[model samples]
Target: MTVTATKFTPEVMLSAPRRSPGVPNPSGKLVLYTIRVLDIESGNSELLTEDPEAGCPVWVGEEKVLYLKTDSRGNTTFIVRSVKSPEPESYDIGKINAPLSDLKVKKLPSGNIALACSALVNPDGELVNPETDKKPLSSAKVYTSLFVRHWDTWNSDRKRSIFYGALGEEDGKLVLLGNTLTNALGGTNLSSPVPPFGDSADFDIGPSGLVFVAKDPELDPATYTKTDLYFIPLKTFTEPQAPAPRIIKTPGLEGYSQTPVFSHCGTKVAFTRMHSRQYESDKTRLILVPDINNPDVTEEFYATEDGAGGWDSRPEAIAWGLDDSHLYVSAEFHGRRMLFQLPSTPSKATQFPKLIETPKGSVVGFSVLHRPGSETTVTTADILFVSSTSLIDNSCYSIAHPGTLECRLISSTSKEGKSFGLSRSQVDSIWFSGAGDYDVHAWVVRPSTFSKDSKKKYPLAMLIHGGPQGAWNDSWSTRWNPAVFAEQGYVVVCPNPTGSTGYGQDFEDAITGNWGGRPYQDLVRCFEWIEQNMPEVDTDRAVALGASYGGFMINWIQGQPLGRKFKALVCHDGVFSTLNQWATEELFFPIHDFEGTLYENRAAYEKWDPARFANEWATPELIIHSELDYRLPVTEGLAAFNVLQAKKVPSKLLVFPDENHWVLKPENSLVWHREVLGWINKYSGVEEEQKSN
Candidate 1:
């Protein structure tokens, strides 16, 4: 078998089948999606019964999709869509966030009923857009997972008013503490009480009590950085007792680490190190340490991947099957991602994956949506993924390994013939060098309809990605507006330049202070490659558009000599200057520095400032960002806009109060897409340019 490296093209990746846990189901079968399922596998899927705005669907029995349906009037309601029955009935979970977290309606071994739930809360009355320099209010649409005591949800805080800058549930007694940002639990409910860290955390229940780790570093509620493990007793606090916290590790690892997992037997623990602190170039190391601190033989190796090859730390979503050998773990190795089940005991030199299931989108945290039965074997077991993407609805899939490729959406639907109507345009992976050995990864989505016989060329559009440490992957995007452009008459290019994650830590680290250096070269090289290889694309008519870190790229590009290569430039919530960004209070985490503060990196930051290049930016630009974009605040875009206006560069700005860093509403999303596409058409009307060429 030939293993081909991914082509840095966007066609296949953008349209690739993806699995996300947005459209949830009772079991991981019926998936509720916003778009109709297209080009799906034969007889494996059932088209959902409701509108595309519906979310979180579950199979009530075998024929129904349990989910929330949103109407055009901006009202969301819970309902059950049936496959065999062909009738849909409203099953209001009532004001609760649809697709309940760890949503389960199962009978216990002892036969008692259990129901759990969660949602984002904003008791602070915060109604401001997130400042790019400060920790944007955690209040903006963040979720907090919960476990409801009973079914009645009439008086819940989330139900009061689902209005603008709305507040989520603040009245429920959420049981599980699974990961950062929210409280999540696994297995049976814990007898131990929850901890108060101001931020979210996960837990493990043992014979002694409940054990969990607070990934935050500082004791200060605002600037927490260090992560530590602590044990909470079953007893509740009557008197004001200062809780005792025990440090699990002396150094406490580094960078951003969380999700301390307990071994199957409950005597040990496993967690991904993510990255090694700040600026440290190493892959996220997975280590297994024993529950007891024994002088001799306390810890042993379970399994681990080498190097900072862009692994997502805090992989708490791991599942260990009944038989120890059949261990399931999620990893982002081999450039793409797949679930690997390695044998517990190694007989041969290579203890390769025992049972494997690779999901379409990059698989993050995962768990057995349904564990194997008492008599189930390694070959005969059920595994569910929490992610699926065909561009519209993010849903889950039930992958029955060892059988026919049976991918059933927990909320999404699979039509009778083709699985889902959703089929991504073909994406091919390719790499190009920016400077020296430093290469960049990219995806190119070609125009839906193209002319091969005629020399007529199509317009090229550059789509930028955020997460200076995050990489743009082969996942279908509900908001990835570039696809619409491709469907029209435009060719789109997205590059995982130097600063992007997934390639390796150094690849990401290289961009820390050199954001405009190697990273910029990579984008330039991508443009040049498209010009040379994709002659069907018009070079001068090409435009650049991105948000956050990607938005920063556009700013830097406008300033560079390569700025002459692009015609129209669009900035979406991009960072304008490094100094202003650094000086502002970013969230509580002290990430601006690992060993020291930004005071230490003053010189490095100055060199990386994007504002310095504003004088050279002559490209006709469009600035579309929100007033409340905290990730890359409106100020950054404003700074660029100020420059463009002052220098008399053709520029415009589109600001929306309803949107934050990301625009989520359907109407808003459509508007955003239409605006971007319109800009491309308005400025880069390429028929004239191509004819001249």
Candidate 2:
């Protein structure tokens, strides 16, 4: 079959289907969704709703689906539809008066439904209008605050408040009850979905109608970025007073505690918490509260003890089995992000957690299906699904319950019969022995036009992954795609060396304070392994490129003895000096905890500082940075480029003033690819005709 490369341009988002535990569907069919719903049993799909701008559908009960839809006027309205019914009932929650942020539906034990929403309102308990509401400290033009500017927006006084509203149907029309539970208490900057770093995993509700909020209550972002859990008795009525919210303090006093999940029996609440309050890189451990009402009685629950991706080992998503005896966790390990099952009450002291087998890719999200009266929770396995992607294929599938080995393809619903016009490239994994006798893994994507029988030597491009802690798993990426390099007739090799997650914790921890040691050696070994085993690779014409931590390694690589191996280098948002990078946002924890503060461990910082080894740098380099990237700060890129210029080395600097860390915008990304590709072609001496498709 002739293969062609196609640029993907669809904006698709899928959400995990929500269903009440122990509730029998009776149909025994599974619904996979991606803007449309596919019934797996019959291999048929029916359009639920399509407005071009609609949120994920939430299961209100066994029969009803609730979701938010926005109209052409930019006004959003809530719609509820019965699964078997054709017409949908719409509710206007006065969005113009109090615009909702994160809307969620919860069922109380009393069988009543309530909506938990976040709205940006003023101190006067009214929705803050950007056009009308006066700014805080009206006279001062230059105001000072820690979170004054986060990501892309300036912080304002219009704080988000969690509101509770009882849902019911009156005369066939949906009626909402109760005012904002938090509005009356002097509007707080309480975010339902915490800003900057929080996800849908930040909060959850129990059958008792107790809504738990994981929020950072107006802390100075510069010094502290801590989020604690707070609970409020959900008001299911319009008239009666709502109870004040109470705090559920964890032992990690200064750290964050979030993604609260209530047990099926509501007897236990499990959440993810960080150990240190200020450091985002601190180990994230699972914490269980026997009684959330008495949160201090908490114990450490070890499910991701194998270590989640470098930063932490906390589960991103959680759900309990119908019998409530097993908890399913979606965690990152090795290079793949997969699901794991932890016995609610483990009988053995040394029985490690059981991994739910799936494809070698990221398990983006999952949902659990259980009958109302099942004999055991063993049948309550998560319908673990992964939007699996590799260097060539972009498909999604759900592993069958009971026997996770059965991989069922559900990509039909998502593709909707549209062909990508892309051919699958020849992909394989290669392992090599590296520093400390450790096995390093690298993913190799062969050029689309090449074959093993051709015996042609293809130019190689070694792509380094960032996170120094993050692994290059079998996943699809819009940025740093190996396929793009392969499309240009270059062999791509992405390795997960020491310090990369997914390997055991001991291996990941090896590069904590010693970033330039084993990881560099592993990269060198990976390169040598490829040149030796893969006769189709042209090692003399190879180039190395990376972003963020990967970018840092590129700088480190140029100073190492292996520097001469690469013809050229590309670094984006890379770290140049540890001492100079101390002021970058969100890196405080890892720099302080792992390497100790600059004052305490000056030698460690200087030992691996790329800026210090400028005299040894001779490779032609391309440095890219973004002004909005406070994480690494654009200064790091500027310093690296200045050093190259001063050393009389061939170099070019690309700055994206409007972008952050990663070049996200379509136009900016095009420029990034063109510039980097152009650089590789020039330095590697590849002809113009061979560089483009």
Candidate 2 lDDT by residue in tens digits, 1-693: 122224322221111122211112223354525444555556555566666677646556665666667555445566766666466444554344334545566666665666666556666656554544555565554556454555544556556555556676667655554423334223344555666755445666665545455446666655565777766644443424455666676653467677788787766777777666665644566667777667557766643343342323446677776676777777777566777777665332145556776655566666565444463536444454444454444445554463456666654322321233334445677889988767888888766567878876888899999886678987667677776776577888989999777776567668878888889989888888987898889999999999988998999999987788889999999989867656565545445434676777888888888888888999999999999987787889899999999999999999999998777887788788889988997877665546453
Residue 577 in candidate 2, Cα distance off native in Å = 2.6
> Which sections of candidate 1 miss by over 4 Å?
1-217, 220-224, 229-255, 260-269, 275-283, 287-316, 333-336, 343-361, 364-376, 379-387, 390-425, 451-454, 587-598, 686-693
Q: Which tens-of-lDDT digit does each residue in 481-588 have in candidate 1?
A: 445556556777778887675665556667655677787788878888887788878887878888877887888888888788888888887878866663233333
Where does the lowest 10-residue lDDT sum fall in candidate 2? 12-21
Q: lDDT score, residue 205, model 2?
A: 60
Error of 1 at 307 (Å): 9.3
Model 2's TM-score against the true structure? 0.85
Candidates in order, TM-scores: namely 0.68, 0.85
RMSD of each: 10.3, 4.9
Q: How many collisions between residues are there in candidate 2?
A: 4
lDDT of each prediction vs. the true structure? 0.50, 0.66
| lDDT of residue 152 for candidate 2 | 48
Poorest 10 consecutive residues by lDDT, candidate 1: 158-167
Which candidate ranks first by lDDT, i.e. highest? 2
